[model samples]
Target: MKTRLFRMGLAVLSLAAGFTLAGVVGPAMAQQNVTLALPAQSLLFAPAYIAAERGYFREAGIEPKIVYVAGPGVLTAVLGKSADFAMISGGIQIAAAVRNQKLVAIANTQDRFTTDIVVRKPVADKLGAVPPGDALARIRALKGLTIGIDAVNGLPHSFLRYLARKAGMNPETDFTITALQPQAMVAAMKSGTIEAMAFSPPFSLTAVNDGGALWITGPDVDLPEMKTFPYNVVLVRPDYCQAEAAACRGFTTAIGKAVALMRSDPAASLAALGKTFDRMEPEALRQSFAIFAKYTRTDLGLTEDMYRNAVAFDRAGGVIPETAAVPPASELYAPSLGR
Candidate 1:
């Protein structure tokens, strides 16, 4: 019995020594690589920019690569395995969910209604100036007014419809929504080509500062039903999550730390963001940060009310198939591995 016990102790010590030697000699063996795709126009993604710049991912044993794509294309890139994960709007996720897309929201990035409607100063003057509570009435009063929108069927458009309905006007009949890129919206607004637009900051900020006036801000027209209206969320494909569960969890932990850092010190976060978006002015960046700070929840948890509202919007609008089953929020959102 003594001889057998001695042999087992020797074997255990040898295995421990081997593991210690491997740890000392090959630290990189435990590290992971992850790629995240983000939309070009989101200030909400500032936390992600901070994570990449600040080496938080490195600290968490991950090497992260960030790719810029249009909001609509992010999910497809992840679904196709071209990217490991993506940051996308909750509305898009809900729409995709109705189609039975195999994507799960791992973090709740930004939830606030950040989109706004800006009208030319002259138009605002004609409509009786800035605090236009009856702005939809004024907007409806104008026949054939063109409003710029990023897409015909996305958040901007959906929210615009919601605002019009709140203001007691028909969006389809009252105004013409012109599809324009965010940058182009600024140029169009400046040139007086498009009288009004549904815009996201810094585009909205740019318009207001450059002489456009706010007709309506998104939150003012409350769509209480829309919960988990995620402006941007971190998503991983099911197959990728199943294959690399540990790596995905590590990435989430790193990202959660980044989000906390950003929320705690936005000025520092903007400095990090400056590395990627060089043209972003310090003031604009600060303003952008402030706007996003109000609505983004760094907790990485999706709200059920928000998800249901988004799902309803997509379903009612036929963005998602009528026959599709909307997954419960729990099934759609993964718990924050970071916490």
Candidate 2:
């Protein structure tokens, strides 16, 4: 009877050990696949690249795929179910929310102001040599002058409006805003088609290097409405977030890790970003990284004040209907995963 009892105990112990090993290895083998959509040319998308290249996503038990899309196609792609998530301008997200699209902002990538108003060198030089300190005055002087913007209702327009108001001018009455893509802004400026424009780097850097005058940078004006503004944000379709909460959490955690890495070692982050850019130039890459660092944050969380401000601006701009309820910051974000 004693021998039989010993053999039975050994069998039970062996079964328990087998189950423990399976439990340990199960999650590692069941990693989920996730896709992130990014714009083709913005430094704001660097963290995503960093996360993917440095294995942060993998470490978090996620298989992340990064996809590049055109400027206008990003929101549509997410809304149409072609992509899982995207990093886009805050204005776009606000606009979508106003339209009652089921999208949620998951992370704040570029959390500060970085756009600038640049003018043609000759035009600015002819206007009595624009001093860097006198940029607001220069912008105000160009009353009725045409200015180019990337979109009619996005960052460039919102920021320009804020700048105009701060400079004691109305965007509607003081200047004529023209819509132009980033790639074409320089050519338009060179040909004198547009006198000045609000742009983000490396486009801003490119324009300056090509002899465009920097008139007013976003931070210089100190616009009340734009203090500590949120720029690029990570967004996911509402359905995706609901259906794959665990996977989404893992993805956010991975991005947060990437942001931490970037903050700790920008040079290493830039090197990681270089892999994403085709024909990358080291100097340009470094400059681009510097510009991006000024705007992005590794916190990976949205603040209530920032969200409220963004919602108010959108509602006033008619991007979101006044009757539309502004969701709480908690509803619009999920940051616990990062912690």
Candidate 3:
């Protein structure tokens, strides 16, 4: 009887040991640490902010550290390995992918071109007060003026080209586009160096209120080409994704929850955003978030039409060679991590 009892005890102990070894029940593991790269620390990326401040990242066992890159330089963060994931514009992402930069978009950001076209007071005066609703007329007024952009071939520049084309003017021949950093852009407009600029808020707000510029937000106008065009996106590197898929997935899932929070609770969303945009007034920030969020989707899903529009816009605007083949969704966005 003693020998039988001993054998049974040994079997039970061995089974318990096997369960622990197989990780069926054990002490919790350390949280996976990751760095997320953001193009700018603006309210334009509310979902990401929602995830971090709302404790979604922590809940998902991810110790997410945000690293900001200036000049909308998020893609470089991934290329340089400064971040595991990057939130940037799809235009930039598609252009980079065409250049063989290895990146996979995990989620889509804002579909509408959220940037506001701010025309200097002096510039608007020269056009003799066109109606606010007159998009084509305002676009026609853009001809023969010097416009400022963040970079030579960046979004502002590309948008100028697209707008010009839609309005039946050649951007290259009709208007002079110049590179002026945000700080310099304001100054240049004040000094009468550049007549107008396409910028995102709170800079857009500043241009209108402080600089006495006319704010013509793109979405308010009818622009078929820019509608539902993938602008901002969350992207990941394949190597890191394959290695830390669970963490990556957790990060993406957290953003989805953030989207819900932003939709359901504006006050909470703005409260969370206060830290990021410290100087921005609560009301102004709230208004801005409402305007941009109207087009933002929680899911990062991108259709072939989205991809096609981006590629066509870039190719048509001469951002890339017309001959460059646009990579499909499989090459451009990683299917596994976000899923």
Q: How close is every model to the real structure, measured as TM-score?
A: 0.81, 0.78, 0.83
How high is the CA lDDT of each candidate model?
0.74, 0.73, 0.76
How much is the lDDT of residue 280 in candidate 2?
Answer: 47
Best by lDDT: 3
Better of 1 and 2 by lDDT: 1
Q: What lDDT score is found at residue 264 in candidate 1? A: 85
Instruction: Give the higher-TM-score candidate: 2 or 3.
Output: 3
In the range 1-339, model 1's lDDT, one tens digit per residue, is 999999999999999999999888765445677778775656767777777798777767778788866656778888888888888778787777766676888777777677888888888777654345554565455446889988766677777766565556767887888888787888899899999888777778888887898777665544554445777778887556677877777777777777787778876777778876676666876787788777767777677777777776665545666577788887777755333
Candidate with the larger lDDT of 1 and 3: 3
Estimate candidate 2's RMSD in Å: 5.7
Model 2 spans > 4 angstroms off: 1-31, 68-73, 129-136, 165-181, 191-193, 278-281, 315-325, 337-339
Q: What is the per-residue lDDT of model 2 for residues 1-339, given as tens digits with 9 covering 90 to 100? A: 999999999999999998899888665656788677765556667788888898877778788777866554677778887888888766667766656665778778766667788888887877785566764676676778899887676667777775565567777878888887776887788788888888777677677777897777765654444555557788887667668887777788878888887778987898788777655456766887787776567676577766776776565545566788766666666554333
Clash totals, every prediction: 5, 0, 2
